[model samples]
Each structure stands twice: as structure tokens, then as C-alpha cells.
Target chain A: MPPEVEGGETTERVLQILSTSARLFATTGYDGTSMRDIALACGISKSLLYHHFADKDEIFARITLGSTRELVQFVESRLPEGAAPSLRIRAFMAATGEYFQRYRWAWIASTTAFWNDPQQRRQTERMLWRDRYEGLIRRLIEEAIAAGEIRPLDVPLAGRLVLSALNWMHRWHKPDQGMPAPEVAEAYFDMIFHGLKR
Target chain B: MPPEVEGGETTERVLQILSTSARLFATTGYDGTSMRDIALACGISKSLLYHHFADKDEIFARITLGSTRELVQFVESRLPEGAAPSLRIRAFMAATGEYFQRYRWAWIASTTAFWNDPQQRRQTERMLWRDRYEGLIRRLIEEAIAAGEIRPLDVPLAGRLVLSALNWMHRWHKPDQGMPAPEVAEAYFDMIFHGLKR
Candidate 1:
């Protein structure tokens, strides 16, 4: 086989390992899981697992960074170019809810019990990504306010509230239960855009 | 000493242990702590500590249960008697925010790393308390809708969104920086009740 094919095969195996580990970590939690457990779950020898990754922390960092990047990209991709600020806000909220719904394990893994002993690099990566994400939302809110699409308010607080609600969806959203992500997003949008007052 | 006085001293000691352990667990996480650490922090012998509580797990259970009870009581006490639905909603939101602010350690300890290996009883207790809390919120929403104080929507979903925004405050709220708890509560109330649409 050519060198490129060999490299591609190695990349696929690494992806498989990361995906499997993410599921296990999400379900059992980081501390509750071990490298041996991951190896067994992946049906690979310990040495082989080590060859693909340095350790469990490396695998965890990869998954978290990967998930965060994907979430950002997913939201950005869904956002319409040159759309009204209100429409942009709706798209952001809907995409966020849907991303959490689809990548439930990734969200769980990034924010749950494993956060206690995060590597410095992982923590920095998360903070940077979070800042960027929040900055985007804050800008959108500012735009909406300037456009007179929404009332003036605390931009940072407003952004935080919206992000918090969307982030919390992973904790309770079950694909099999209740309304689908789109409907849930619609209800949330209605509530956020229109005051609860009749 | 009189029997009553002796019992009172014992109760004080138990409370001391619980308070100190809650701080430690909150700051360092449960798995990061040990019985020895708790004993040192409490300035007591490990044997004495064990005498009061069977183990760390027991201590954790006691703190969590106590905190949950206090949170329920706090919200209940703040709720005005025979008030309008909107007022009741305000009280609930304010109380929820304040409870998390005051009992920051308890909220941190209960929700963080130790949640993975929870005893069956602890899980059941958490579920029971959560059900009660959510039920209360849902009822308030239903009452608000009936009173035409707010538009009709999915009661459970609305309740979750509100609770999520409140609960996520612990992750980001800084008492010394930015808005205080009451101010934060007011902003949330405004956004939640009045929405963003002008």
C-alpha cells in the first residue's frame, strides 16, 4: 500500500478510538473509566492503544477539543450570511440545541465530572473557545439591539442566559422523549423573543 | 453537664464537620478529598469523625440532603402567601438565585465529580428532591398561564429553561464581580417575563 493509504488507515483507527472513548467517558464518567477499560472496549491491546495515543488524558483532550470545534463550526455553518440580527439569533439557538442533541456524549464529556482535573492545555483550550463562542453571541445581541430588533439590555448577561439555557439542554434532552429539538428550540425562541407577559 | 447540653454539643460538632467537609469537597472535589483530609480540616481525630459519620459517603449524603432541604425551605419561605402568579414566579426566581449564591459550596459539592458513584439512596434522594422542585416550578407556570399572566407553553420545558439558567449561575456568577445575585435575578426575571422583543 502507498504511504498516504497507510496514513489514512492510521487516522481512521485514531478516530475510532476517540469516538469509543468519548461514549465510555460520557456514560461512566472520566474517573470511573480507565485505559485498560478503554482498551478492552476498543478490542485492542494496551500497547496498540498507547501507540495511537499517549494516554487517557490525550484522548480526553482530543475529544473535548474536537467536539468544541465541531460545535462552533456547526453553529457558524448553520448561520445565514447577511441575515437579520433576530434571524441570526434564532439560527444560533436552534443550532446550539440541535448540536447538543446530536452530540450528547461530547457535551456530557466536556462539562460533566471530568472537569475536576482538567489538564492546563485542555482548560485553556476550552476557555479560549468559550470566549470566542460567547463573543459571537454578544455581538449578535448587540447587533439586534442596535437594529431595534430587541430592547437594550446587559449584553453579557443576555448572552450568558441564552448560552446557559442551550447548554443545559444536554442534561435533560432525550431524543426519544417529549418534543423534538426544533420544536423545543421554537418554544425557547418564542419565550426569549417575546416576554411571558400576555 | 446536663443531657440536653451534651446532646447540643454533639450536634454542633456534627454541623461543624458537615460545613468543613462541604467546603473541602466543593473546592477540591469529592474524589480529590479523603477522610483524613476531612478530619484534619475539622481538627478532629479520624476515629471521632468516623464515629459521627460512617464514612465520607455518609457525610456527603448528609450534607446533600441537608442542603436540599434548606434550598426547598428557602424557596418556600420566600414565596409570598396568596400572591399573584407573577409575584410568585419572581419570588421563586430570586430565591433560587440567592440560594445558589449563599450555599455555593453545597451546590458545587452535590453536582460535581462525586455524582458518578452515588449510593442508590443518595440518587433516590436527589431524584425525589429534584422532582419536588421541578413540580413546584411547573405548577407555578401552569398557574401563571391560567391567570393569563404569561402565555401558554410547555410547562415542563419552560420550567427546565428557567431552572437551567438559574443553576448555571454557579458556574459563572461572581459575587465580587459584575452584578450581585439580586441584580442578576432581576435581569433574569426581566428577560424571562418580558423577553427581548420590544
Candidate 2:
């Protein structure tokens, strides 16, 4: 095999392990899941798994880091350059809900990892992505206010409210049930932009 | 001591243990905390602690149950016999924010427990309170719609959004920090009632 192809295969194998591990961890939880379980779930030997990850925590950390990075990138990628602030906010929420729906295990694993493990490295990485994600939303809201699209309010608190509503989607959103992400996002945007009052 | 006073003292002691355990659990997580740690924190013997509750799980269950009941009662108490739908919704959010602030530990413990442990009984109990709480909010929203106070939207999704914003308060709301519960509630209610539009 060519050198680049060999490297690509290795990367694919590693991603496969991480994906399987995330599913297992999401269902059984981090503490309940074992390395053997992950290896078994991935249909790989324990030795092969060890070759890729030092241990379960390493696998978990990698999964969380990758998932967070992917979510931020996905949302950022969805935004058009020089978009209006309202358009930016709408795109962000719609993309986020869709991302969570498509990558349910990643969302669950990343969320669980942040709360379950307080290791310094994991904490720093989690906070980095969290701050970036929240920062983007805050900036959009600020722009909206500056442009006179939305009324001025407590910026930090408003950011928290917006992010909280979006993040909570993972908990109740089921792809097979209820409104799809696009419709849900529309409802959210409508309520958010128009308030509940008639 | 009189029988009633003796019973009250025992109840108080149990509550004290639970309160201390909740604080420890919130700070150190459930797995990080032990019976010995809770006993030591409560300045009581392990036997005395066991006498009131069978185990840590039992203590946790009682704490969660009590906290849920108290929150429901508090919110209920805050509403008058026949208030406006908007008033009812306002009372619910304000009371919930205040309840979370006052019993921060309970909120932390209960949330952590629901996510960390998948015990059937605990799941059922958590859902019971959650459903009741969400149901109340949904009913209030429905009433608001009928009263023509708020425009019709996805009721369930709106409930989730509202609850998410309020629940997320526990993560960021510090009594000694930036915005107090009432002020935060005001901001939330305002944003919730009126859209971001100028």
C-alpha cells in the first residue's frame, strides 16, 4: 500500500474505535464501561485497542475532544461569511440541533465525560471548546443588539439562555420522534425572535 | 424529651446529614463521596447515619424526593388562587430560580444522580417529578395560549426550552455572583415573553 493510504487506514481504524467506544460509553456510562467491553463492541482485540489508546480514559478524552471540535467546526462552517446577525443565530441553532441529532452518541459521550471526569487536562479542553462555542453565540447576539435587530439585554445571561436551550436539545431530541431538526429550529427561532405573546 | 420533639430531632439530624452529603456530592461527585466522608462531615457516627437511612442511595433518594416535593410546593405556593396565565408562568420561573438558589446542593445532587445512575426506581422517581414539573409548565402555557396571552407554538418544545433555561441557571447562578435570582428571572421572563426584536 502507498504510505499515505496506509496512514489513512490507520486513522480510519482509530476513528472506528472511538466511535464504537462512544456508543458503549453513552449507553453504559464511563465508569460502567470497560476496555474489554469497548474492544468487544468494536470487534477488535484488546491488544489492538491498547495499541491505539493507552486506556479507557485516553479514549474518552480523545472522543470528547474530537466531538467538541467537530461540533464547533460544524456550526462555524454552517455560517455564511458576513451573514446578518439574525441569520447567524438561526443558522447556529439549526445546525446545532441537526448535529446533535446526527451524532447522538458523540453528544452524550462528550457531555458525560465533562461531568464525570474532572481531570485537569479534560477540564481545560472542555472549557476551551465550551468558551469558544458560547463566545460565538454571544458575539452574534451582541451584533444583533448593535444592529438594533434585538433589544439590549444582559449579554452574558442571554448567551447562557440561548446556549442552554440549544444544548438541552440532545436530552429530548429523537430523530425518529416529534419534529425534525429543521422544523424544531424554526419553532425555536420563531419563539425566540417573536416571543410567546400574541 | 417529649415524643414529638424527639422525632423532630431525629428528622433534623437526618436532614443535616443529607444536606452535608449533598454539598460533598456536589463538590466531589457521588462516586467520590463515601459514607464515612458524609458521617465525618455531619459529625456523627456511621451507625447513627445508617440508623436513619439504609445506605447512601437511600439518603440520596430521600433528598431528591424531598427536594422535588419542596420545589413543586414552593412554586405552587407562590401562585395565587386564580392568577393570569402570564402571572402563573412568571411565578413558576421566579420560584424555580429561587428554589434552585436556596437548595443548590439538592439541585446538583438530583441532576447528577439522574444522569449518573440508571436505577429503575430512581429513573421512575426522577421522571415522575420531571413530568409533573413539565406538565405544570405545559398546562400553564396552554392556558396562556387559550387566554391569547402568547402566540401558539410547539408547546412541548417551548416547555423544554423554558425548563432548560431555568435548569441551566444552576450551572451559572451564584448567589454571591453577578445577577440574583429575581433579576435573572426577570431577564429570562422578559426574553421569554418578548422576542429579541426591537
Candidate 3:
């Protein structure tokens, strides 16, 4: 009896479960958290937890897949279609910041999930979403290079340079403290887009 | 009983334990790895393990602190004495790449250890080392700005931009797989130093 479109209380409970589970996963690591721990933290019974998820992997998959899907959709929506690749790249950073701020815990948990782990790599669907997200950036870089808007560079490496800054934000960028996420993203983008050299 | 000024076999054994533990910690998260697991994985009796490390935190601190110390020393040695900030920054990246590849597991496990975790923050000594490493970069950036080698920008953010690129290397840059680590670092530095814009 996995969650269905039976909105209202069930939806609320599911969201609660997902968020709580995400925090635990983020702090404790995926292999560290158990369904029993999740249920205890969520104030739900084992039976109820089982009713919602087949097991820990199912819960993990649901949370990670959902987060990735939301991120992809959010970034996609922000891109100015048919615009210059540089503009789209800017949008990508801005959108990442907004999305990260809105769902800090889940976003960090999902993105930081160890895809290289042998067990995790088995999640083929999740890997596909990751590829899609990474591919989008690489494609934009390629387009920019082709159009002569940006200097020719290694597309894959270029994509990594842009993403590494945004992905590592959670390490230092405190939410609701210091500069906002969007501005930090903008600053990083500016540094990357315009050379730091005088 | 903890490891002290012992050399020869004792030191070799200690090195072996630290590396094996780093792999487990990196894959399983700090909270997830137990002393028993480490002992079992190392194929040493739990008593012998305890003789070498009082507890998990001590082992963890040893690994992280040692790695950071090595990293700082390596990077510092590479810095051309009194060189321009730009040249020093390049050395920093190259050193980081080389260090990362040399101690791949321990380097990553040490650097990625969650300092933000409340429990981890109590490791004041570890935090100090981290600050020192980061401070070195910040100071270099500040000097560059003062010397007008680079445009004036947020010093802290500039440091993050530089570090984020290096710190996130373990994610995609495989050791001995494709492009060499130093070259990858050089390429990233080039992108940051020279704007992507044509």
C-alpha cells in the first residue's frame, strides 16, 4: 500500500516521512539509517512505515528520485529557451540556488548521495536522472563553444567546474544567514564567467 | 597503548589501519562505521585495535588531522617563495591535485569529514587545521587583490570558488583513469583565471 494520489493527510504524512528520512540520511549516511529509525523519528509505527515503503532502499529511491526530478524540472523551467548558452548557464546557477534554498536538507542529501558506491550505482534510474542533469550542462557548454560565445574547452571538465561550486555550497553557505543562496550563486557565476584576473 | 613514536612494523601497521579505516569511513559515513567493523575489516583483534586507538573518534581525528597537515605542508612547499599571487594560486591547485591522487581515499575521507556535524565540531584541533588550510588560500587571494593581480572581489567567496573546484575533484576525477589529476587541476585553474567568454 505505497502512497497514492489520496491527497490530504496521507500526502502530509508522506511528505513528513520523506523530509525526516532525508535529514537522517543526510546526517547519518544512507547505510547508517534504518527503517525502524525512520519510523521512530517520524512517530509512526513499523507497520505503518512498511505500508508506505517496501524497505529502506524503496524509501531512499523515492526520496532521491523525487528530489532529482524536481531539480531537473526546476532548472529546465528556468532556462530561457533559444537564448544564448551563457544566459542559460546563468539561469541554471540561479535556479540551483533557489531550489537548494527551498529544499536544503533534501537537496543536499540527494546530491551528496554517493553515486560511486557499488550498491548505489545499481540504482540505474537514479543514475539516468543524474546523467540528464550533468548532460544538460555539458550540452550548453558545447553549444556555447560552437557558437563561439565561450572559449573552446573540455566540455565535461567545463561542466564540472561550474557544478563543483554550486554543489559544494552546502559546506559553507548557511541558510538564512550571511548572503542568500541566489546571490552566492551569482557571485560564483560572475567569477567563472568573468575572469578573476584584472 | 595508543600509537606513539614507534617506527618500523608498528608504524607500518598503523598506516595500514588508517587507510583501511578511511575507505570504510568514506563509504559508510563517520557515524556508520563502528570500531568492531574497523577491527574486523582490518583483520585485527578488537583488543589490538583498542591498543592502537582509544576509540573511533581518536582514529578519525588521526586520519583527518594527519591528512590536513600533509596537505598544507605539500601545498606550502610547492609555493614559490615570495612569488606573485597568481603563481602561488596555480601551485596550490597543482599541489592539491597531486596530494589528492597520492592519498586518494584518506585525502577525501579526511577533507569530506563533516565538520558541520555538532559532534565533529568539538574536535577543535581538527577544526584549527582546517581553518589554517583554508586561511592560507584566503590570505593568498587577499594578497592578490592588494597587489592588483586580480580584480577586487569578495575574498571569502573567491577562496571558496578556488577550493570548491579542488575539493570536489574526488567526485569525477578518477585516479589514473582518464586525465591526470594535475592536468585537470591546471585546466580548472585556467578556466578560473581566464574567463570562458571569447
DockQ of each: 0.68, 0.63, 0.59
Residue-level lDDT of model 1, residues B90-138, one tens digit each, is: 8998988888777777777876633364677776876687778888889
Per-residue accuracy of model 3 over A1-198 as CA lDDT, tens digit each: 123322354577788888889888877767677999999999999899998888887777777777777777788989998999888898899998988888787776676676433245546776787789899989988888898889887889989998999989988888889999988988888899887899
Model 2 whole-model lDDT (C-alpha atoms): 0.78
Cα error of candidate 1 at position B1, Å: 28
- Candidate 3's residue-wise lDDT over B129-189, tens digit each? 7788899999998888889989998989989998999989988887669988988888888
Q: How accurate locally, in lDDT, is each candidate?
A: 0.79, 0.78, 0.80
Clashing pairs in model 2, backbone N/Cα/C closer than 3 A = none
For all candidates, the clash counts are 1, 0, 0
Q: Write the per-residue lDDT of candidate 2 for residues A75-187, one digit (tens) a residue.
A: 89998779889888889888888778777786887775555573677768767988899899899999999999989877887788787787667667777887887667767
Model 2 lDDT, residue B136, Cα? 92
Better of 1 and 3 by lDDT: 3
Please report the candidate that would top DockQ against the real structure: 1
